[model samples]
Target: MRYVLGIDGGGSKTVCILMNDARQVIGRSEAGSSNYQSIGIAATLKSIQSAICSAVTSTVKIEAICLGLAGVGRAADIENVKVLVQELQNSQLLPIIWDLQPSNIVICNDALIALVGGVGHDVGIVAAVGTGSIIFGRNHQGKTKRVGGWGYILGDEGSAYKIAIAGLQAALKSYDGREISTSLVENFKQHLSLASIEDLIEVIYRQGWKVKEIAALAPIVDLAAASGDEVANKIIDNAAEELIKATSTVINAIFSQNSGLEVITTGSVWRGSSKIHERFTASIINEFPHAKVIFPRFEPAYGAGLLALQRLTR
Candidate 1:
């Protein structure tokens, strides 16, 4: 039976799934993120290989492989992944496509697949706020572009990472007696299991935590906001505003032919019970006036695999 492999390589984790010729999932595997920018090409390739190996488990020919990866937007990164796939093929690690670039190997930004999950039927937008945030859009003609996904330091403004960091800052402001807010002092102590914020000093100074770990606190921020914390509410509002901005930017950029558009929200943060999603959707509808925001029907990786199928029909 012919098989296809699809991978959603995010900043925090890699999710790999193998589909049969009939598009039934036969194998699934999970590994660390294959983001070359964060994990280096060698490491990324290795992680991908490990995940693929686990997915295969048994020897089976692969008809194609689609990798929706973070930090793989550059042509050079795509070429590198192609070469790595070639190497795996020669060694019989897994079945590889004979030709590059959509020939058994298709590489695109992770956001592209996210868009596919929602806007498959018509032109729409996909905004994801997981560990990081990115908003992607595609028109009916398949013309797609990125709005904001600059990463946590700069953009990624609506991402969980952004929210969590902002929450920490607000907590610090409270500690310094600069802002009036919920008992960040009490909550943070419970959240981090520390005697006090002073304990955080040592942790921050020497034993640093991974950014994902910090981003994990985003839900807590949402809870705080829901519980009536002003600082947390502001952070959520800012993130929601940023997300709205990303969607608008893409809709305006590509939908010049028709400002009327469909928008689908994705990712953990958007799916949560934050009033932010409600506010963001309302803002989008108000501004665009004709935009129809909907929920995504499938996961992004499914879209990536379908894109692989798209190449074959051509």
Candidate 2:
């Protein structure tokens, strides 16, 4: 029996799935970050290898491998990952002597797979907000457009990282009496287990908390919003507006505003109940009355698997 491998490599983690011709999931494994740009080629390859090894146990030939990864948008980035895959195939640690060649392996930016997985199709817009945010859309003619996804430094304006950072800043503002007092300060102290506001400095800087850690704080802000904190609700509202704006930008670029578009919303930010999702949905519908907003039909890795299956047909 022939099989295929699908990989979704994100800034936070990597997921690998092994599937057969019938689309049955036979093996699944996860590993650390595979963002080559952030983690380096060697580390990224090592993580991917570890995940793949755990997922493959039998001698079945892997017909194709599709990877949807962050920082792989440009042609050069795709070429670099192609070379890395070649190294993985040559590495003695690979579980089997597979039929995978560069031609059989497909690599694309993570957003594309997210779109495919979210909508269960190749034509639609995907608004993904994880630790970062990006909106990607493809038209019927294969024309594609993207907006946002500038990373935490430049943009990622509607992302969990942005929301959490804003909450932290609001907490500091409340502490310094620069803004109206809110539950955020107390929530921050309790969540981080800080003795005092002064300790936040060490936690943020000296402790070296990174993007994922900061993004984790987003739920806390959500909790505050749920409790009816005006400050928290306002933050979520602003975030929702930003995402709506970005989504609109892509829709306008690739599809007419009046078009009947299917919009798939994915990522951690959309996983739970938040005012952000609600406001984004409302705003998008107001702008594009014919647009339909929905959640992902499948995970991004599974979308990659579907792409791998297509490779076999080709």
Q: Rate the local accuracy (lDDT) of all candidates.
A: 0.77, 0.88
Question: Residue 208 error for model 1, in Å?
Answer: 1.5
Q: How much lDDT does candidate 2 score?
A: 0.88
lDDT of 2 at 103: 76
Worst ten-residue run, lDDT, model 1?
93-102
Each prediction's RMSD over C-alphas, in Å, is 2.8, 2.0
True-structure Cα RMSD, model 2:
2.0
**lDDT, candidate 1, 116-223, per-residue tens:** 757654357888778888788888787887887887777788888888888877888888888885655577779889887778776665688767777888888888
Per-structure clash totals for the candidates = 0, 0
Question: Residue 299 CA error for candidate 1 (Å)?
Answer: 1.8
- What residue runs in model 1 are displaced by over 4 Å at the alpha carbon? 1-3, 20-26, 54-61, 95-104, 121-123, 256-260
Instruction: Count backbone overlaps in model 2.
Output: 0
